[model samples]
Target: MSAVTDNLGLFFGGYLRSLSICLWALVGSLVLGVLVAACRVSPVPPLRAFGAFWVTTFRNTPLSVVLFFCAFGLPELGINRSFFFFGVLGLVLYTSAFVCEAVRSGINSVSAGQAEAARSIGLNFSQGLRYVVLPQALRTVVPPLGSVIIAMFKNSAVVGAFGVGGDLWSTGQTLTSARGLETLPVFVGIAFFYLMITLPAGAILQIVERKVAIAR
Candidate 1:
């Protein structure tokens, strides 16, 4: 009991650091996702092609591979990291590709008539999308987006394989190595930490979905 209590602070500090990275990754992914969705839906062939390529490439590639490329390969190309920025960057870009598909599906769920009605009211395409279309689409996508964020948060642990410090899994490894403790407690602690992040996010998404349904 004393051992567990003794290491609790260390465990929590690492969990919080990882959570912060996850939150930043979530925001970055959402913004990039919105842009990619726009590109996918655009009438221009080049834009559509670019979006398709991005989504396919990133979605199909493994997350760890992407992290390795960005964290290690990028440094060779002159990109340096002050902290664990590259790990977060990799999570953002890789996860954003998946988010883009989710957002695009939500956009498709909005009927063409909605856009047409906005256009008939004298709104331009961009204006209609910004005001009428995207709001609805975003509302519809909140649940899925939340799921993506939770998954991204969990997966952030994988960065530990690349020597990224101060994350939950990395902390577990450090603790286990130092104390020669059994793996079960360390992993259980990690799972609890992840649940702390995912559950609230899931509840918030459910609330947003209900609100959107009411608005509709």
Candidate 2:
């Protein structure tokens, strides 16, 4: 208990690192996920096939393997960068697969007539998706997407294990191993910090779900 209290600043720094990783991963995944979703729904056969391949390859691959590849594999190919960069990249790549699927499901839920209506108004495919289909699809998938983001918050812990220093998980390790603090208390503090992020997110998502339901 004293260890946790004395090292509050250390633990807080770690929490902020984890938060940064989550935020960066979330933005990257959402952008890439939307593009991939567009590809999956594209009229172009090659685009659809590419999108399918991406989803299959990443979605089936374990997150740890993906991180391993990014952490150890990329530098061999001359893509050297910080472990933090690689960690975030791996998270983005892995999470984007799930995000793609979620958005694709939402796109499927949208009425086909919506696309036809957009086309009838002289809108191109890109314009139709941007102005019409995606807007509605996004609203429909809000809950699922929220779940994905929440999962991402938990998954960010893995990044610290892969040499991205100064994250909550690694901080716990430092306390337990280096500082010789009691493991249980250190991890209890770590769990508390994670819950701090996820619980409020879940609450906000529920509120958003309610408002969306009312709007519908």
Top-lDDT structure, candidate number? 2
Task: Give the 10-residue window scoring lowest on summed lDDT in candidate 1.
Answer: 1-10
Per-residue alpha-carbon lDDT of candidate 1 for residues 69-150, written as tens digits (9 for 90 to 100) = 9888999999888447888889989999989999999889999999999999999877888898899898778778877887
> Alpha carbon lDDT of residue 15, candidate 2?
87
lDDT of 2 at 193: 93
TM-score of each: 0.93, 0.98
lDDT of 2: 0.93
Write candidate 2's Cα lDDT for 78-193 as tens digits: 99999999999999999998999999999999999999999999999999999999988988998999999999889999988999999999999899999789998899899999
Backbone clashes in candidate 1 total: 0
Alpha-carbon lDDT, every model: 0.85, 0.93
Reference-based lDDT, residue 103, model 1: 94
Over 4 Å off, model 2: none
> In candidate 2, how many Å is residue 63 off?
0.3
